[model samples]
Target chain A: MLRIPCPYCGVRDQSEFDYGGDATVNYPALDASEQEWFEAVYLRDDPKGPHTELWRHARGCRMWIIVERNTVTHEITGARPANPAHAEVLKRDFELETT
Target chain B: MGRYSAWEIIKQGLTGNKGWERAWRDPEPKARYDAIVVGGGGHGLATAYYLAKEHGIRNVAVLEKGWLGGGNAGRNTTIVRSNYMIPGNTEFYEFSLKIWENLSQDLNYNVMMSQRGQIVLFHSPAGRDAAARRLNIMRLNGIDGELLDREQVMKMVPHLDYSENARFHILGAAYQPRAGTARHDAVNWGFARAADQLGVDIIQNCEVTGFLHDATGAAIGVQTTRGEIRAGKIGVAVAGHSNRVAQMAGVGRLPIEAHALQAFVSEAVKPHLDYVIAFGGIGHFYISQSDKGGMVYGGDLDMYNNYAQRGMLPVVHDVHECVMQVMPSLGRARLLRSWGGIMDMSMDGSPIIDKSPVEGLYLNCGWCYGGFKATPASGFCFAHLIAKDEPHPAGAGLRLDRFRHGAMIDEKGAGATAWHH
Candidate 1:
């Protein structure tokens, strides 16, 4: 099991959190073109090396955090709060009520 | 290669059995070839076989980073079925199933294709409705499908949990009598031997490190660990490593992800489970009994994007719980072994058999968890694409541009996510 170090709850088991997908994707503007929105949402990257992804502390503090880890090695390099600026955009686009 | 037959076996047994030759030749890599297939799994070997047999292209090379069939070709649970629902997927997989029906005779090797049947059990009303829709589509396409009631399912599989106090009540199931399993290793060996006899070089341990591209950005050959080998055309049948291999030719990202899907086998017991059974509720759990009496089964993907060939404990735990919930009598079965195979999960859950953006480079990938069953058709269609410079009718819908064109063949109606599919 991956011991993810949540920014809020410290290190915890992987089962305690829900895997939110790629964090590097920046939500497009509300009035952006459909193609742009599709690219932003569907055309996500599957990087082989270190990647920044979202992880929700579902069984812990109930906060979303960005965790930078190597996908190949499954090593967590860093953790931080999710981009606060994209909170509303994520909520609207991803149907995520919590950030 | 020596032909395998009952008479030949008897003669060899009587004469000290020293005349058996290796299934394939281990030859040094040549300077060049007419075409080069990058992966030596079942698909690649079958591609070479068809390229020689059907297309009359005998000068081919199949390069493998390791031994043939060591990848997912030998790692899957060996379930074969064509009960797909979508247009593109349904036709293509049915073609594959047809090919598999005659594969042993065509290759002159016994693959042990068994049509024991399969059942996908449903718990909720919505799930049953979805299964009914899929069965309707299958029947319309000439594929056999039967909706079995709870009592019928109980008669089919008496060991299934049927108690009134069960958490997920078994409502009904979608049964496909033609679906079954094949001997996985025999398939690899058969294809390799046939391709070798047709003069296709089966080169193992020859890892392609980079691509040899011309000034116009067309892949002309590959630089491998055994040295550089040029080819007029290149076909990549690498499953999970498709994205990494494409990067060697300067192709950008792919709509594929590599995630580990693990399989498990239990200690051999008495012959019990006769049919391949699958759970269609929450977790993706499927089980079947091997010929040796071992219970071979697997669950969902590890739920992470990684190339690791081993999975974590949570999936194991989840699979165990589901298996016990379904077949409570098997709770005492001892676990023997488990291994993972990296799946090339596509954005739309369907496979891609198309020419790459780079000229002279063909791609056959994004098989997800269905590669084993699609081996023959994937090879036949991919060989057609690589040889004729056009997609075969059976696989025409699996275009690399489908994701951009919004023509995605979303088999499970799961949008865009690799693991969800």
Candidate 2:
């Protein structure tokens, strides 16, 4: 089982979390071309190595986070909150704790 | 190497059984061929077999990184069914079922196909109504399906958890009488031996590293670990490694994801279950007993995007819970072994058998979890595409541009969530 370290809920089993796929998907404009919407909605760069994806701590804090993990080995490198504002808060809180 | 008949079997048995020959030839990778099939799994071997047998493209080569059936061909729970409800999938799966029906006779090899039937349980009235509609569609398509009530289900297959206080008690089931199991390795070997006998080279340890493209960026051949081998046409039917091979042809992102699906087998016991059981009420779980008495079963994908041919502990626990919920008697059954296979999960949980964007390249992948059942038709249609450069009638709906046209064959109707399907 994957041991994910949620930004709010230190660490927990993967069973407590839910997998959100491909974090790199950039949804196109509503009035975009059908081709652009098709590519964004369907196509994926499902790599063999490291993949940056989304995970939700559904059973714990219920916060979404971005995790960089290897798709082949299931080795997790790091994770941060999905919201940039929450990530900024984490950085600031860490700085305050250290200082 | 020769025809396997009753007379031959008896003669061999009487003569002390010393005249058996190797099933297929181990040939070196040739420099060129009429068609090159990358991946020697069941689909690829079947493609080569059909290419030679049907299309008369005998000068073919099936390149495998390892032994012929080393991949997903031997990794699946050998259940076969054709109960699809959609237009695109309905015809394709039914065509595959017909092929499976005649496969043993056509190949002169015993595939051990047992049509014991498959029962998919439904929980509530609404679920039963939906399943009834699906079965109605299937019947209209000339596929056999029966709606079995709780009493009929119990009578057909007993020992299920049908207690009064049980959560999500079995209301009824959609039973397809013709759906059953086959020997996985036998399917692979049957296709390989048949293809090899038709003058197709079955080359092992030939890893395709990249593609050879012409001036117009059209794929013409492949750069393998052994050497550069060219072909007039290239058909790739690699299941888990579809994207990696497509990348070799410089075909960028695909509408697919590689996820690991795990299967488990229980320690051998007295045969109790004769039919394949599918229960999606609690969690995705399907199970059937092998002839050796081991209960072969598997559940949903690890529910993550990983290519490792191994599963995590959580799915094991989850699957065990579902198993107990479905069949409480199996609570004491010990797990014999568990293995994983990387699945090519298409965005809409359907397979694609169409020409790749690159010239002279044909793709036969995005099987998701339905690869095993669709092997025959996947091969036949892929061979049709590679040989005639046109989509086969059964596979005509399976196209690379379906999503662009908003024509996704979403079987589960789950929209974008792939594993849900």
Candidate 3:
């Protein structure tokens, strides 16, 4: 089972969470064309390195979270609520761990 | 209820001789086979039969430790869909869908292949986006997948819980017109008969004890519970027991998890479910009513990893509750039976069909719960690999080395939830 680290509820089984795709996907501007909209949603780098993705704790307290995971080993190096400060802390932790 | 003795069903249906023995109780394995296929499930028998019929490789033996198809093949909820996102997987599964289209005619057996259509419901905007992207990709790959609107989805199944307060109100669904279900047993029996007719020995009770390696450290034969069977080529079609079998060949650990996936059947009713109902938000619960009027349904893999065939009470309770929530009419229906099967969930939640690092030992497994759907194509592709000593174009990326080479074809982006396939 996918072990998702719920930012609010701590680590839990993936059965409790719904996977949101790449975390960097921002809603396009109101006048965006179909091509740009498609690129924003459909196109992804999907690199084989560290990736920041979104996950929702559906079965628990419904909250979207950012999970920094390794595509190779499937290890969650860091995770936090989809908040700026939380993301900053995660980024710092990741940097410290990598270095 | 879905509880009927196999004897009662087969008593007057059809039969001259009760074909295919339960070989687990018998002894004596034959030596010198033209082809020795491991894992005597539907795929193994189908491959053996196809080899004799299509390629004329007649001297074959299907080695099985237990009753044929008693593994994941028998335990799967019998869903067949070729609606894939990736080009390679989509193309390969389309070929399998073709075989499924004419399978009953080709096998001359009643597989009960019902193209009743399968609807995958999306509850959230993210889910809808994913479904739309998948539909677009499927269309690009020449597959008939459509994004159905709320009205269309309601028209297909009116009894679904569409009220706004429900979990994530059903946004819409991705429907595949051709995707359907089949009788799992018929698939196994059909292949077994065909293989038996074409001089392929069905060796049951023959557990592979160890791999017999040549002087150059290549697999030349396998020592079985009965005896040693030497063959020019060997195919491991085992699914859940993939890691154990791979170890016998001195292969590295597979990036696969063994998880128990459970399925339940409800009491017979005046068939309420017309098509397969799969919820993307509701724990991957896919339910379809069988021809017998029993609700044959399944939920996600059990949270823990174990080989236990029995399921926990909470999982069954959750499934029953979820099924009730999906179709309120099924609330009073009694769950007649529930069972679990070990799934060989690959790291990418896709199958692996590769010539292993060990020479002469080929793999055709990691199918998770998709063995029944890919039976014909798996046999076709795996036979090609074993016969030609190379990967078929369809199964090229399925190589075991793809993990090391950084080329993974994850059908579902369950890369993190990979273990739950």
Q: Which stretches of candidate 2 lie over 4 Å from their true place?
A: A83-99, B416-421
- What's candidate 2's DockQ score? 0.68
Worst 10 residues of 3 chain B by lDDT: B19-28
Clashing pairs in 3: none
Looking at candidate 2, what is the lDDT of residue B399? 93
Using lDDT as the measure, the top candidate is 2
Q: Give the DockQ (C-alpha) for candidate 1.
A: 0.48
Give the worst 10-residue stretch by lDDT in candidate 2 chain B. Answer: B412-421
Per-residue alpha-carbon lDDT of model 2 for B160-278, expressed as tens digits?
A: 99999787889999999999999999999999999999999999998999899999999889999999999999999898988888877887778888999999999999989989999
Q: What is the lDDT of residue B408 in candidate 2?
A: 85
- lDDT per residue (tens digit) for residues B32-61 in model 3: 887899989988888888778877898888
Better of 1 and 2 by DockQ: 2
In terms of lDDT, model 2 sits at 0.90
Candidate 1 ranges beyond 4 A from true positions: A30-39, A42-45, A88-99, B415-421
For candidate 2, the per-residue lDDT at B210 reads 88
Instruction: Give the candidates in order of TM-score, highest first.
Output: 2, 1, 3
| lDDT over C-alpha atoms for residue B272 of model 2 | 93
In order of listing, the candidates' clash counts read: 0, 0, 0
TM-score of chain A of 2: 0.82
